[model samples]
Target: MEYNEFITHVQTLTQSDSREEAERATLAILKTINELVPDEEMQEIAVQLPQKLGEILREKETKSNQSFNLQEFIERASQKENIKPTTTAIHARAVFSVLQSSITPDVFTKFHKYFSHDYEELFFTSP
Candidate 1:
């Protein structure tokens, strides 16, 4: 997807008030993923995304050991995006949904493998 289409999907999925909100959420999640996924894996995921969106993942380098769990992951994005922790999960799922749909399945499988099983919850909304 193009950057606008990706932002639109995120806004629609998260029910954001504007494009900026969706963009912020997208960056927050992408940066958070940058901290979690290894460099090689992240590079693979980045190449499949829109240039602008991929740049966020490429530009932000994290020295974190990536020892955090799912809850911590949400909290980090919430803090970075300057949104409520409760809402961060919603934004994260929206971003993940967009990522899954936009990228190749093989690359997505590789991306998904980096996160633990509990993190799978971020990929889908609660039923």
Candidate 2:
């Protein structure tokens, strides 16, 4: 799903009348983000994401009809953290790593297709 859709889902899942539920939802989102990004990248990105996501949820709560500003969120996240803004590349690597570490060889062929040329280009271009 797109970030906007994912955020909407998260917001819905998180908005409980209770503070405890909200906290739990935040933790779940953080876990998902950690699982999705490289471990090294997580610390930097995590510093900014929870607050950003909370802002998004707050906006949705106050202005029920307003459309979510997903592009702005992405732009802000990348700029604030000095991280690459490509979700596909990040998620592809995360899923590939998870499959590699846990799944059997029979599933490798299915998971392998998710790997992207962007990562290869990134690897080659790095100093």
Candidate 3:
């Protein structure tokens, strides 16, 4: 996915009217997610994304405060985006759904391993 495609798909997927909104949601999602997974795993995932987005994730991957779990991840994401937990899930699912199509299956598989099965519903947009 290229930069425009990645951002557009996320905006369309999340039904966001503003470009900044989509960007914020994506940044929060990626930043929060990178905090949960190992940097190596995120690097694998990032290489498959658009350069801009890959850089975004990579920048976040090196944070010292990366010990948060799924629930804390959501909380931080929600706070970043100024939304509720449920709304954060919507944003995260938008990005994850894009990631599903963009990254290798194995990378996404590794992503899920960092969390419980409860995250499946949040990380994948069901058909």
Candidate 4:
């Protein structure tokens, strides 16, 4: 999706009040995800992302790399954005939903392999 479409979808999904809020949440979610997936895969995904979003992911390329499961992923994104884990989970699921639609299903599955099956709900909002 284009950047505008991306932001609009995020705002709709998150019920964000303003453009800034949506941008912050989207960038935070992307950056947090950048820290999780491997460098090579991140590069591949970045190519499919918008210019600014791609740059955000690339900026994390040389930063510290972290490996986290589903809960820790939500916790870290929450801490990074200074939000609650429950709230972060919602934002993250929105991001993942966008990614699932934007990226090839094969590559999206590859990214999820980084997490465990417990994250399935975060993927498709399963019960």
RMSD of 4: 2.3
lDDT, candidate 4, 37-122, per-residue tens: 77888887888888878788777643534766788878878877787888888888788888777878788778878777777877
Regions of model 2 farther than 4 Å from truth:
1-14, 49-127
lDDT of each: 0.87, 0.35, 0.81, 0.79
Worst 10 residues of 2 by lDDT: 59-68
Model 1 regions lying over 4 Å from their true place: 125-127
- Order the numbered candidates by lDDT, best leading: 1, 3, 4, 2
Which candidate number has the best TM-score? 1
lDDT accuracy of residue 111 in candidate 4: 80
Against the true structure, what is each candidate's TM-score? 0.92, 0.28, 0.86, 0.87
Q: Please list the Cα RMSD from the true structure of every candidate, rounded to 1 decimal place.
A: 2.1, 15.4, 2.3, 2.3
**How would you encode candidate 3's per-residue C-alpha lDDT over 16-83 as one tens digit per residue?**
89888899999888877777777788789888898888887788534533565667778989988998
Shift of residue 23 alpha carbon in model 4, Å? 1.2
Candidate structures ordered by TM-score, highest first: 1, 4, 3, 2
Q: lDDT value for candidate 3?
A: 0.81
Clashing pairs in 1: none
In candidate 2, list every pair of residues with a backbone clash. none
* Candidate No. with top lDDT: 1
Higher-ranked by TM-score: 1 or 2: 1
Question: Is 2 or 3 the stronger prediction by TM-score?
Answer: 3
The runs of at least 3 residues in candidate 4 whose Cα sits more than 4 Å from the true structure, single-residue gaps closed, are 61-65, 125-127
Residue 34 lDDT, candidate 1, scale 0-100: 90
Please count the clashing residue pairs in each candidate, in the order shown.
0, 0, 0, 0
